[model samples]
Every structure is written in structure tokens, then in C-alpha cells.
Target: MASVKPWSLVLVVFCIMSLSYFVNGAGSNEGLGASFIFGDSLVDAGNNNYLQTLSRANIPPNGIDFKASGGQPTGRYTNGRTIGDIVGEELGVPSYAVPYLAPNSTGKAILYGVNYASGGGGIMNATGRIFVNRLGLDIQIDYFNNTRKQFDKLLGPSKAKDYISKRSIFSITIGANDFLNNYLLPVLSVGARISESPDAFIDDMINHLRNQLTRLYQLDARKFVIGNVGPIGCIPYQKTLNQLNENECVDLANKLAMQYNRRLKELLSELNGKLQGAIVVHANVYDLVMELITNYTKYGFTTASKACCGNGGQFAGIIPCGPTSSLCKDREKHVFWDPYHPSEAANVIIARQLLSGSTKYISPVNLKQLRNL
Candidate 1:
């Protein structure tokens, strides 16, 4: 070929690289396969098999709504995808991986990130012990560490560590179970140790949660997408229990949720400030979910007041909405898939808002703007 001018060569390179980024949305990375997640049923793909918690979705009706599963839903609490899955969609990451419990698809640890997020887990010890097999936050971190070693064996420490710290997305979504399963269930605060002092309990739990998170930051985690607790008051099951209460969710629980969020915000701020070169982003599921609850009319959700599963009074919310279970004809019209979870369609809407370009809530700097940061 004839010698090309230097400016012409530079233009060619710029055009080619721009196509890879704008069209592909996949950025330069150390080869991050997926977003590794840890926490509760909010994001659990199939890791509850590792925990002894009653807060589980490894059952029928749970996965029946997941369209991506080809009409076979996994044990996700939502009808289709959790916030994590949709978040993965926004981040250009694959659906959160169940690397810890699922058998290797191709006998490789190179699948997207592993999800150790078991349903019913919490910051408190013995939180999800009701299940025969479960994993707490500590064990989840241990899983990440073990996976690091395994990947190191496959690709060596330098490459493996780079993949985690630079390329991979790290997300954590837990804590609702701490209040729902432990403190607020049965509509009574009796027999619950946390009930001894709910306020103190929240402070302690947030502190413990922060410690676990700080540990993750220490372990080569820099690009963090930390999820705050969603609205606990508006779950269909809870509403059923408090039907007489003028649409008011339990005050104590909601107060504590807000308190916990405040603490977590403070904690993340401190963390970002302390750690150099850290990109800590808080996914505010709190208001993102509450908007669906308060503004259901604006969103075209007909039955934000009722879950689409089962029958009868508040009892149906507790009962799983399955194949035999009563379901609304139009799922897109309902905000909640079951009592405590959002429908797949609702999740998509929330995901869209979260990734909306006008606001930068998911990250202090959205991925689109992260390059300058």
C-alpha cells in the first residue's frame, strides 16, 4: 500500500475506537466477565442453596415469570429480574452470576461474576439460619477470595486481580430481611432481640455492614455499585397485614430503614474519601422503589395496592403466586409480582430511570461520564 499520511492514520484509528465504545458500550477493561454480586433475595440467582434461610425463591412460581429463562424462572423473588439483573443490563454486564452454587456451565470460572447473594441474609449473625443451607456476607466474601485464588490458578494473580479491581462490577444488595424476616414479621416486635432496642439495632447492623463493605474495598474492589435498601413499607404482604392502618406502613420499620440509609450514605462517603482512586456509587433503591409505590397512577400500575398472586385477604401475599396461583391477566399493569417483589416490567422501568442520563444517582459519575473522572 502507498504510505498513508500521519493525520489520516490518526483519523482512522479514532473512528475505529469510537465505534467500539459508542456502538459496543463495552469499555477498555482488564477483561471483566460479569458483575459479581452478594446479598439477599433481591439479587440471588441460585445461591440460597448455600444457606439455611427461609427467605428463598428456589421454587416454582418464583421463576415462572422470568421471560429470559425461556418460561422457566429461577428462584428470583421478582417476576422476571431483580434490580441487580437490570443493573447488569445497564452496566453492559451479564445477569448477576451464581458462581458459588451453580455447576460450571463449561467447567470454567471465567463466567461473569459469581453471585453469593442468598435470600433472607442480613448483617446480623444467624440471620438466614432458618434455611438448611445459606451464606452470610462473611461467607460471600470468602467465596470471592476463593474464586480469586481459583482464577489466579487459571490466569495468574496479576491478571486475575486486575479483572476484579479494574474490569469487574461489584454490587451488594441486602438488609431488608434484617427488618422483614427478623424484626417486623408476625406484626409484633416480641421475642425479637432486635426489638429490645430497634434504633440501637439499626446502628449496630449498619456498622457491621460497613465493616463487611470496607473489607471488600480492601480486596481490590474499586468500581463499586452499592445498593441501598428498598422501600419496606410498600410490599403487598405488609400492606395486607396493615390493611386497617390507612395506607400507613409500620412506622418503626420505615423509620429504621431511613436511619439505615442515612448511615449507609455516610459510610459510603467516608469510604470514598478514605480510599484513593475509588469509584463508589450508591444505587438509591429507596426512592426509586417508593416512586412506584407513591406514584403508581403515573406509572400505569393498576394494582399497586395488591399483589398479582393467590387469593383472599392479606393471606394471599404470603402464599406464592404460581402456575395454579391467581395472576392478573396483564402483568405490565401491576407493579408488584408478588407481595414483596417487583414485576419484571416494573424492574425494567426502575432500571431505565436509574440509568437515565439526566440524573447521576447510580454513580457519582455515571458510566458514560466516568472516563473524565
Candidate 2:
């Protein structure tokens, strides 16, 4: 060949590099993989919208801040993105994991993983009966099992197994409702409290969770990030319902949460040790949330104890966020969106920590580390 001109040679190299970039999907989220989320309203996308239950958030102001739905409610309890949604976005997940009950959850949608969480879901079968309908952990797993079968049909058995075990993260943010709606209800929980001590109830929860995690492992789930119960006593609802001071939280509720959290940490440690090739990481939601509530100013929050959308006393937390609820003009300044859920701003802070925080918040490894593994 004749001597190649310098400009022509440079152009050829640039074309080759551009082709490689497109082929490898570099700088793009091509291989971050799917996320299978399991939990209650905290992580629920829109499963409750399809269910006939008292615990539904498909009305206005619920998703007023969720950009995915163009500010329309998508059955999420919060005003915007949940922790799960934020984590997925930060991890470069291409899209939100479609809710299992959504009409579009079939076909190619299932390949991106599925969210099986419901508004009132819990660990025990009878945990949220007051809601009339909710998918407990057992039922969610059953739904996952069915999803796994669908995966087999779509990608064949071996490839589907590999996809699920290697290219997915099983995130569970449950347990709060088991305490909030089950063991803490005054009239409804009287029978349970009398029949079982707090220790006994926690033991039951642990046992059920053990089986639930084991079941997921058997179904080829190798990565898990289990968020321990947060400081539920500090929620706007708890504060308002009990007439607590701005700085005070319900001691009994916090005590129960800490107790269960301790056991849950131990249980996760056990699972990590016992299960081969499994990485069961713990996300310290309690400390993270408590930090936000205690140092709200540091986190750019104006009010940590009040709900941005509700109708009631000081906290505006007795009533859930609805059409006639008192909507706050400064939504992002409030730590909570309603009585029980965190605002999208608070969620962003928590998600950043979980994604790249130190071992103090996410033990063993943070979400970014786990994703790489």
C-alpha cells in the first residue's frame, strides 16, 4: 500500500474506537443486570394498585414527585421514588423493575427482574390481615418462583439460572409492617400480644425469614441486601398518634425494632456463613434514618418530624396523604412525605450511602461493591 496520510490514519483509528465504544456499550449501563425487589410499602412500586386492599396509594399526591409517571400517582406510598427505585437508578439499571402484578410484567419485562412487594406485606402470613389483602414474604416468594419458571421458558434452564444467580441482586426491605400493622395494633394485636411475648413474636419472625431467604437461595438467588427495620417509632404517624414531642420517639416501638434488628443481623451472619456462594449483606437502615432525623439540618431538611402531606396536629401525620390532605409547598425540605414514608430527597441521601457508604452502614460490602461482585 502507498504511504498512508497522517490525517487519514487518525480518522481510521477514531472510527475503530467509536465502533468499539458502541459494540461494548462502554459508558452505558449495559451489564448492570436486573434487581428483584421484595418488601412492603417502603419499596412497593404499584402492586397494591392491582389489589383490592385498604392499603392503596393510587391517588393523587402519592407520586407527585415521581418523574417516571409524569407526576401522576403510581401507587407508591411516598411522594416520589422509593429507596429501591433510587438504588436501581444509581446502579445504572435501565428501568424500574415492573411490579409483579402490573399488566406489562409479562414477556420482556420479566427479564429486567420483577418487584413483588405490596403495601401491607410482612414476614408472617397473618401480619397484615387488617389490610384485608397483601402479599406476605411467603406469597412474594411464590410469585418469584413463578417468575423463575418464566425465566426458564424465556432463556432456557441453564442460562436462566446463570442470569438469576449471577446478574441479579435480591433486595428485601421488609419487617417494619410485621411490627407496625401486626404486633402493635391496639385492638387487633391484643390477642397476639397476649398469646405471644415480644421475644416469642420476634422469634417467629426470624424463623419465617430464615425459611424465606433459604427458599430464594434454592431458587438461584446468590446476592442479597436485607435492610433491617428502620426507626419506625420516629415516623410522623407514630409521633403524631402518640402525641410525642418533636425530639421524642416511642420507646417501646424503637425497642422492639432494635431487638428485631439485632436478631436479624445475627441471622444474616448465620446465613452468610451457612449458604455457599451467597453474599448476604446487611443495610443499616436504622442508623442511616436516625442520622437523618437527628441531623435534619445537616442533611438540608427543614422538618424531620413532620409529614409534608397529611392532615392532623403538629406533624400532620394522623391522616394519610390524600386529595384533601394538607400539601406542603416545600416538599423536598420535609424528611417524610406522609406519615410513614420518606420523601424522595431523603431517599436520595439513603441511597447514596447504601451505594457507596462505609462498612458502618452497609456491612460486609456496600451496594456498589456487591454489584461488582
The C-alpha RMSD of each candidate to the native structure, in angstroms, is 5.9, 4.5
For model 1, what is the alpha-carbon lDDT of residue 140? 85
lDDT of each prediction vs. the true structure?
A: 0.70, 0.92
Residue range 130-177, candidate 1, lDDT tens digits: 554567788888778777767666555786676667667677888888
Q: How many clashes does each candidate structure show, in the order listed?
A: 12, 0
Model number with the top TM-score: 2
**Candidate 2 off by > 4 Å:** 1-31
In candidate 1, position 197 carries an lDDT of: 79
Per-residue C-alpha lDDT of model 2 across residues 162-231, encoded as one tens digit per residue = 7788778999999999999999987989998999999999999999999999999999999999999999
Estimate the TM-score for candidate 2.
0.92
TM-score of each: 0.83, 0.92
Distance (Å) between predicted and true CA of 318, model 2?
0.9
